[model samples]
Target: MFSERFIQYIKYEKRYSAHTVTAYQSDLDQFMLFLNNPGNADPAPEPEITHPSQISYHHIRNWMVELIDQKMLARSVNRKMATLRKYFKFLLQEGVIETNPASRIQSQKIPKSLPVVVEGDRLTEMLDSDEIFSADFEGRRDKLIIEMLFGTGMRLAELLGVKEQDVNLHDGVVKVLGKRNKERIIPVNTELKNLLKEYIDLKKNQNFDNNSFTLIVTNKGAGAYPAMIYLIVQKYLSNISTQSKRSPHVLRHTFATTLLNKGADLNSIKELLGHANLSATQIYTHNSVERLKSIYKLAHPKA
Candidate 1:
C-alpha cells in the first residue's frame, strides 16, 4: 500500500520516466520481498517485517551486503540504494516514519571510466560508404539509426521517444523528451535534415504503420526497443571500433567529443546534449584531452 502510493507519486508528481518509475517500484518490491522472507540469510527479522516503520538501517545494510554477495556491481547496488533513500524520504515526508533509515547509508564508490568515441573521420567515412548499407527499408533505417544517434547525440531512450512531429527537417531541429520527462531541442545539420525527410517519405511510401508515432521503427513498423537498437549499433560498429563498448551510447559520446574537439563550449554542448548540469557535459572535455594525448604520442618527436 505504501509502495503503491510511492510509485504513483514518483510516476506523476516527480514526473520520472516510466522506465525509472518501474525500476523504483521493482527495487521496493524486492526489498519488501527480502524483508518478508530473507531465505536463510542472517538479516531475517523475528517476524515478517512488511511495515515501513519496522525497517531499520540494519535491514538495508544487510540487503546491500546480500546484493554484493550476489555479484551486483557497485553502480547497480548504489542505484538500488538510491531507490531506498527516495522511498524512505517519501515515507518520512508523509509522516509514515519519523526519520529516514536510508539517510544513514552512503552510496558505494563507483569507478570512473572515460567515455569511448569513434574517430570522427573514420565515422564519417563509414557513414558515407554506400556499400555498407543496402537500399531496402531496413537498410535505410539502420543507416538512419546510426546517423541520428551520432548526429544528435541523443540517448537511446530519447531516440525511441522521438516522434514524427518532433523531427522538424525544415527547422533543422529535433525535439526530444529526455530523462525525468524533461524536453529539450537539439539542432540537426543539413545532412541529418535531408536524411529525416527521406526516411519520412520512405515510411509514407512503404505504407507502414505509424510505428506508435515514433521516428525510429522496426522492420514491422513497430517502435524500436533497446536490444534492437543495440544490435544495430553492434552490427555496424564492430568493424570500426575495437573498444569494449560498441553500443549506441558510443555514438552519443562520439557526438559530444567530436563537438568538443571542434571547439564547442561545455555549456553549449551541455544544452545541446540535454544534460541537466554542466558537470555531466564536462566529461567530453576529458575525452577531448585524451584524444590530443593520443595524437601527441603518435606524431611528437620526443625521445
Candidate 2:
C-alpha cells in the first residue's frame, strides 16, 4: 500500500539511517494499529483507517495522548508525531491526500537535557591502561571502537559504515556517510590514525573477508551490527564510567563536548559531526556551560 511507498521514500530518497528508517516504519505501523478496530482499537469506535484521507488531526492528537498515557517519554512521543508529520506531507504530495492533517500539530514540550560527557583525563587513562584492553584482535578492535567514537564525534551508524577505501591515512582524513547519505570528510588525529593502521594491519593478517567492505567487523570476520557495537561500547565504558548511560552515543557526546570545551568553534564541530545545522552542535555549548557551572560550584571559596 501507500505505507510501503512512504517507507521506501524515506529509505532511498530521504536516505535516512537504517535505524531511523526502521523506527519510522515501526511508528507508522503503530499508528495504523491504532486505526484498526476491535482487535487493538481505541476505547472509541475508531474505524480501521485504510486511507490517508481518513486520518485527521483529532486522531493524531488522541494518539499522542494515548502514547503519553502509556508512559512513553515525551521525546519518544514527539518522534512518533514526527513520523505522522512526514507521512502526511508525503501523502499530500503524492495526491493520496489533499491536505496535510498532521500539519500544525504542536509537539509535546520536553525538558532541556544536556549530553553526557566523560572527563578527558578519565578517557585517556582508560584507553592507556594495559589492564583495560588486551593485545589481541578483538581487544584492540573493541578499544578502537571506544577511541573512534570518543576521538571523533561520529554516530554509531557512521562508524559502522566506514570502509577501508574511505581511509586516507597519509592525508589524515576519513570519509563517512553521515545522516541522509551525506558524505563528509573527518580528520583523524595522530593517535586514532596510528590505532587505525594497527587495526587494519591486524585485520589483513588475520585474513578476515569482512574487512573487504567494512572497517569494523565481528570476530568471525563478518560485518558488525548495531547491537554488537553497542555491547562493545557498553562493556568497555562500564570499566571507567558509572553513568547510567554508557552507549556509543555517550562517547559521541564526550567527543563533541570535548571539542567545544577545547575552544573549537561550533561550525567546525558541526562539520566534524556531520550535523546539517549548527543548532544540533550548539547543545555541546550548553554541556560546556553546565560543566563550568559544576566546576565553579565545587571550587569557589566562601560566598
Candidate 3:
C-alpha cells in the first residue's frame, strides 16, 4: 500500500518518466524482499522486518554488502541506494518516520570514463554511400533513424515518442518530447527534411493499421520499441565502425562530440541535446580536448 502511494507520487507529482518510475518500483520491491528474508547467510535466526519503520542502518548496510558480493558495479549499487534514500526521504516528509534511515549512507565514488563516439568522416561515408542503404522502405527508415539520432542528439526514448505531427517539413524542424516530457524543437537539414517527406509518403501508401500515429514503426506498422531501435543501430554501425558500444546513446554522444569539435558552444549543445543542466553536456568537451590534442600532435613540428 505504501509503495503504491509512493509510486503514484513519483509518477504524477514528481513527473518522472515511466522508465524511471519502473526502476524505482523495482528497487523498492527488491529491498522489501531483502527485509523479509535477510538470507540464509546469517547463522542466527532473526525476525523478518515487516514494516519500513522497523528498517535500520544495519539492514541497509547488509543489503549493500550483498549487492557487492554479487559483483554488481558500484555505479549500479549507488543508484539502488539513491532510490532507497529518496523513498525514506519521502516517508520522513510524510511524518511516517521520525528520521530517514538512508541519510547516513554514502554513495560509492565512481570513476569518470569518456563516452565512445563515432568519427564524423566514417558517419559521413556510411550515410552518403548508396550501397550501404537499400532503396526500399526499410532502408529509408533505417537511414532516417541514424540521421535523426546523429542530427538531433535526441535520446532513444525521445526518438521513439516522436509523432507524425511533431515534424514540420516546411519549417525544417522536428519537435522532440525530451526527458520529464519537456518538448524541444530541433532543426533538420535539407536532406533529412526531404527524407522525412519521402518516408511519410511511403508510409501513407502502405496504409497499415497504424492507429498510434507514431513516426517510427516496425515492418508490421507498430510503434518501434527500444530493443528494435538498438538492433537497427547496431546492425548498421557494425558495417562502418568497430566501437564496442554501438547503441543509440553512442550516436547521441557522437552528435554532441561532433558539434563541440566543430566549434559549437557547450550551452548551445546542452539546449540542443535537451540536457536539464550544463554538467551533463560538459562530458563532450573531454572528447573535443582529446581530438584537439591529436591534431596538435600531428601538425606541430616542435612536438
Which parts of model 3 are misplaced by more than 4 Å?
38-41
Clashing pairs in 2: none
Lowest-sum lDDT 10-residue window in model 1: 38-47
Please give, for residues 1-303, the per-residue lDDT of candidate 2 as tens digits: 388999999988888889889999899989887766474455666656767798888888877888988999999999999999999999899999999988978998999898887777799899989999998999889989998899888999999999989989999889999888889998888988999999998888887654466899899889889999999988888877888898899999898888888899999999999888998888889888877888988899841
Off by over 4 Å in 1: 43-45, 209-211
Worst 10 residues of 3 by lDDT: 37-46
- Worst 10 contiguous positions by lDDT, candidate 2: 37-46
lDDT of 3 at 270: 95
Q: Tens-digit lDDT track for model 3 on 117-157?
A: 88878997899899998978898899999999998899999
Off by over 4 Å in 2: 39-46, 209-211
- After TM-score superposition, what is the CA distance of residue 292 in candidate 1 from its true location, in Å? 2.2
Best by TM-score: 3
TM-scores of the candidates are 0.95, 0.94, 0.96
Tens digit per residue, CA lDDT, model 1, 54-132: 8899889989998999999999999999999999999999999998989999998988888888887898899899899
Ranking by lDDT: 3, 1, 2
